[model samples]
Target: MSDIKIYSGSSQVRVMEIKNILENEGIEYQEVNKMDSSYAGIFGEIQLFVSEADAEKAIQLVETIKNK
Candidate 1:
């Protein structure tokens, strides 16, 4: 299964929160440091990736957190 972007944000806290949600839900994922594209996050943000199958679920989890 191909990995796809599930979330992207500038806040490490936000990224970790989403990651925890995925972990709690048993949805596998990966953390991509968009910072590598710039000055090590000084000019970019963090990105979360999951398998294509988990992308939708991961997004839903993010939305749930957003609504809170």
Candidate 2:
């Protein structure tokens, strides 16, 4: 199994914000988008994932951004 963790979801801007935080903190991550197709038009959720070892650190960086 893969040792990846999901840190956040929704909107591209939100995902990018979290990504920036992680990068500033020297943490590595991967972004995954789950797209949905429907009559209402296409939409998707953005997921930010990091290695298990960096999960805690990534979460912390996101939290810091949240608290600011």
Candidate 3:
């Protein structure tokens, strides 16, 4: 079986919010930082990851928040 899928968000706060939503829904996920040294002096993007199966649900949740 394949491991869960992962996504990359743009900011730490966004990643954390997504994580909390996933946790509340009892979904498992992994978060990884895609930052590199070239971005050290500048603002770096953060990533919010979830399993491929959960991708739709995660996106829906975020969309809901955005719509609100």
Candidate 4:
């Protein structure tokens, strides 16, 4: 199954939190860093994805964290 994007953001702390949440839930995901290295914190975002099969649960978990 294809990977489905469930979250995207530029905050490292937030990103790490979500990653930890997913890991703790036993959800496998792929993280793509699109931040411009040369500019570091000046631009871009980090994206998180999971297989299509896991997308719904992943998105729900991420939303709960985001709403907190």
lDDT of 3 by residue, 1-68 (tens): 34454446556666677778889998887766666657642455556667777777877887876576
Between candidates 1 and 4, which one is better according to lDDT?
4
Q: Candidate 1 lDDT, tens digit per residue, 1-68?
A: 79998788777888889988899999999897876554554678888899998888888899999899
lDDT of 4 at 61: 95
Positional deviation of residue 60's Cα in model 2 after best superposition, in angstroms: 1.2
lDDT (Cα atoms) of all candidates against the true structure: 0.85, 0.70, 0.68, 0.92
Residue 63 shift from truth in candidate 1, angstroms: 0.7
TM-score for each model: 0.82, 0.70, 0.64, 0.93
Full candidate order by lDDT, most accurate first: 4, 1, 2, 3
Best by TM-score: 4
Candidate 4 stretches with Cα past 4 Å from truth are none
Better of 3 and 4 by lDDT: 4
Off by over 4 Å in 3: 1-7, 36-41
Total backbone collisions, model 4: 0
Model 2 / residue 42 / CA error / Å: 6.9
Mind giving the per-residue lDDT tens digits that candidate 2 earns over 1-68?
A: 35576554556666788888778778888876674645212466667888888877777777887788
TM-score sort, best first: 4, 1, 2, 3
| Model 4 global lDDT (CA atoms, 0 to 1) | 0.92
What is candidate 1's TM-score against the reference? Answer: 0.82
Per-residue lDDT of 1-68 in model 4, one digit per residue for the tens? 79999988889899899999999999999999999999866699999999999899999999899789
Worst 10 residues of 4 by lDDT: 37-46
Candidate 1, run of 10 with poorest lDDT: 34-43
